[model samples]
Target chain A: MSSERSARSRHRAILVLTGLGLAAAAILATLDHFTHEPIALERERRALAALTAVLPADSFDNELVTDFIEIGIDGLAMPARIYRARLAGQPVAAVYDVTTDRGYSGSIRLLAAIDPDATLIAVRVLEHRETPGLGDRIEVERSNWIRQFSGRSLDDPPRQRWAPDRRDGDFDTLSNATITAGAVIEAVRRNLEHFEVLGESVWSDPEDTEHD
Target chain B: MKPEHQDIWRQGLWQANPGLVQLLGLCPLLAVSTSTINGLALGLATIAVLVCSNAAVSVLRGQLRPEIRIPAFVIIIATTVTVVDLTLQAWFHDLSRALGIFVPLIVTNCTILARAEAFASRQPLVPAIHDGLAQGTGFAAVLIVLGASRELFGHGTLLADADRLFGPAAADWTIQLLPESWEMLLAILPPGAFIALGLLVALRQWLIGQTGALRARAGQSEAAA
Candidate 1:
């Protein structure tokens, strides 16, 4: 009788603890839902700011959010979401949200903007897991290495010169982060090439088809 | 409030410090101490979670069965950390981004669990709160010192990117004490964190030894007299 009573009490204790855990989780979930909206707004604001930084001020007039296309391309880890900018109803540039798994640690997300002439406008490292003092030099905030890709197209530096100078190319790698620099250079060059291959198709009108 | 509570505070803050003495939660300590603002942001988040968890644990102490107490404490700590993580992401998006994986990883920080078990589970509500604050402050102090040391040595700047912790008004708060070309890569890496923390621990031990010897000598002189 005593043993049975103790077992029953233990079970009751476990059940009570589980109930409390669920209650706590539920409360947190409610709070998270309430807070998620503001976070989403901040993220959108940041994305818009990043887009504006890569493109010139006078280039686009329409909303880039509404004028976008999504497609999966080779070499990229996931489906690339390309935002299009239009000046007077004509396509001015295409911005591709491409991610590469070639980073030193994990994936490095990039936003590559290409002009109507298929030349590269600018490439920004949106997010990365590279070492801070070493590979993180890819960030414009960290170093100007990323800014060098602004004016250069696929042919200006020539296809062969896309690799880092240490690899017998024009671009230079960071002091202690050759692998990361090489990976970024390749990701950017591949993105530019991808844009050139697709041309106008990269910026298909949103109202045209159900690519979803 | 009470003499007992004061002892608890002293133990948490100094004698058995969560950071320097106990050496709990070193993952975030070493990883995020690259910048002062980063460390401060993480430290504040931790304090918020620790306080809430300790309070919750103390309240539920009577009801929790010993057999399942560990899991219960973990659940409480994890919930608190998640709430903190969400709050930071919502209100301070930039700091949230800067902290990266370290915020959610706070759930794994043993200091919260240890405090919940060793102090809160057996203490009254007021004392639990006191312990949480003291321990959190200790952890935060160590984080800030390590962060400042690393930043000053690594980038040769103090409070670089202070705006991340403060706001837009603090954008120019960065003071560059070294030339642009000056940078010590080792100081920003994992090795530097270990070395700095080791030195701090050694200094603390040496100070404690000196104070103990002084007291012993004073007691001997009085006895002789």
Candidate 2:
């Protein structure tokens, strides 16, 4: 008799637990249904903002977010999105959205904008998992370390000198963030080289380029 | 002014602060307290989750059996945290990015679960809600204090990035205490978090000791008279 009573209570426990779990799931699903659209919209807005930050407002007349081409590039672990900047139907600059896996912690995504003449307009870190106080100096908000890339081109720093000064290169390394600094510098240089190779063709239709 | 409500406030705030006394949720407390804005953002998120989870658990306490109570609490807390995480992502994009994984990790913050088991699950709805506010405020207070001290010492400013939490109108809320170039890197590192929290815990202990001694002395004088 005691065994049967205990078995009934145990069965009731499982039923109660299942009921609570289902209720929680229902609530979560409802919230996700409502928030899904706004979350995507917010992500797109931030991405567009990052692109805008890398290029001067006066430099680009076209919508930077909508004006873009996707291509697979070397050095970048993933396919890259190159956003074309135009001023009154003429190409002003091309911004390469690239990701590098060489950061001290993990992947670091960045934007490198190159002018028509192959000179760098600016570079900005979009996302990174780097150590906060040490490697986060790569952010334009944290320090002006990334701003040093402005006006730099392949020939100015030369091909071999495109690295942190710690490695005997032309660029200065952030204090205690040598690896992260090196990764950003390397990614920027690689993107510039790719841009130079593409030349005026970078502004051409996506089908013409053999980047695939 | 009810005795039970007052007792709850006393325990949550001073006598049993999650940060200084219970030492609950130390992971988020120590990790995100590097800046005032970061700490404040995470603290607010934590408070929201705690209040919601406590209330839910209290309302359903009768159905929870000993065999399944723990799992039930976990589901409720996890669901509340996800809702908060999504809400932040949708509305407060910048602050959400600043907080990163810490916001979702609020589910693992033992303070929420501890309160559910210790106070909320057994209490009435009103007192359960009261306990939630008290405990959450206590935890947030410690975070703000720790964050301010760390930001002042490490970055040489207080509320240095207020705009992240309070929008662009608060861009100028930063108060620079030291020169921008004069930063003590150690103060913002993990080791600094440990040291600052240790000092805070020691300060609380010293204050309690002093108050106890004063009360004892007053009692002895009264007996003599």
Candidate 3:
């Protein structure tokens, strides 16, 4: 009789524990349901804001996300996503999300936006693992070094001039972080050249080709 | 203050500080304390999570079986952190972005779990709340002091980018301690954090020793008089 009673108590303990866990899960799920929408909306708002900052404002009327295209190009580690902006049903600007592993530490992800004439609208570092207080100057929040890329076209500086100052390039490299600065300059130049070669095909269709 | 109140402050603020004494939750402390605004933002977030989690744990203490208490506490803390994290993302997007992974990393902070298990799980609702406030304040105080010292030396500025944490009105809150060209790169790096923390620990030890000696001298003087 005592053994049966002990078994019954153990069963009760398990039941209580399970019940409490379920209650906690239910409460959290409800809270998550309420908060998830706002968080998602905020993210969307920020993404649109970033798009406007890099691409010219008032140039594109249609939604950017709905016009997204994904293409895997040879010589690139990962497939790139391009957000094509259209004005009156014609493609105006393309923002390429490119990640280059040539940075001194980890990958440097950036949005290189190109205009219809193949001129660079802006090159903004979306994310980077470079050393802070040094290479981080690539970030628009940290410094205006990134602003120099705006309104620059492929033919203006010439292809060779895109190298870092250390490599006799026209662009100035970040102090004490030459490798990081060089990598960014190279990646931006390469991605811009890719956009030029691919032209409007980047938005119309996906293609994979090895271009150096 | 009443003895109970005093006990809470003494334990949370001085005797068992989460940053200096208890040495709990130092990852965010050393990382985000690079600037006063960052520290304050993270500190407030932590306090919010701590208070909410503590209160929840206390309310559910009776029903939580000992064998399953740890998991229950973690679930409660994670839920609280997620709520805080999502709230920040929704309302304070810029600060949320600046804080990045640290905001989510708060769930892993041992201090919150320790309090939930040790104090909140055994105590009533009121004391649990009080303990949370006290501990949070202690942690924030250290973060602010460290942040101030680091920012002053690192960037030669105080409350720089205050607007990032506050709002548009605080745009001019940045104070230039050094010329615009001067920047101590070391002070902004991880090594600076280690050095600053070491100095803070040394200062605390020195202060304790001096106070002890002063009290001894006072007793001798009283006896002689």
Best by TM-score: 1
| Best prediction by lDDT | 2
Q: What share of the true interface contacts does candidate 3 keep?
A: 0.46
Give the per-residue lDDT digits (tens) of candidate 1, residues B85-202.
8888899888899999999999988899999998899988888988898889889889999998899889888888888889999999988888867789889999999999999989
Clashing pairs in 1: none
Q: Model 1: residues >4 Å from true position, as ranges? A: A205-212, B1-3, B213-225
Ranking by TM-score: 1, 2, 3
Q: Residue A93 in model 2: shift from native, Å? A: 2.6
RMSD from true fold, candidate 3: 4.7
Report residue A187 deviation for candidate 1 (angstroms): 1.1
- lDDT, candidate 3, B127-200, per-residue tens: 99999999888888888888888888888899988887888899999999899887888888878887898898
Report lDDT (Cα) of residue A36, candidate 3: 82
lDDT of 1 at A10: 90
| Model 3: residues with Cα > 4 Å off, grouped in runs | A1-9, A74-77, A203-212, B1-3, B213-225
The candidate with the higher DockQ, 2 or 3, is 2
DockQ of each: 0.71, 0.71, 0.54
Task: Kindly indicate the candidate among 1 and 3 with the higher TM-score.
Answer: 1
Model 2, residue A177: C-alpha shift (Å): 2.4
Each candidate structure's TM-score, on Cα atoms with residue i matched to residue i, is: 0.92, 0.91, 0.89
- The local distance difference test score of model 2 is 0.89
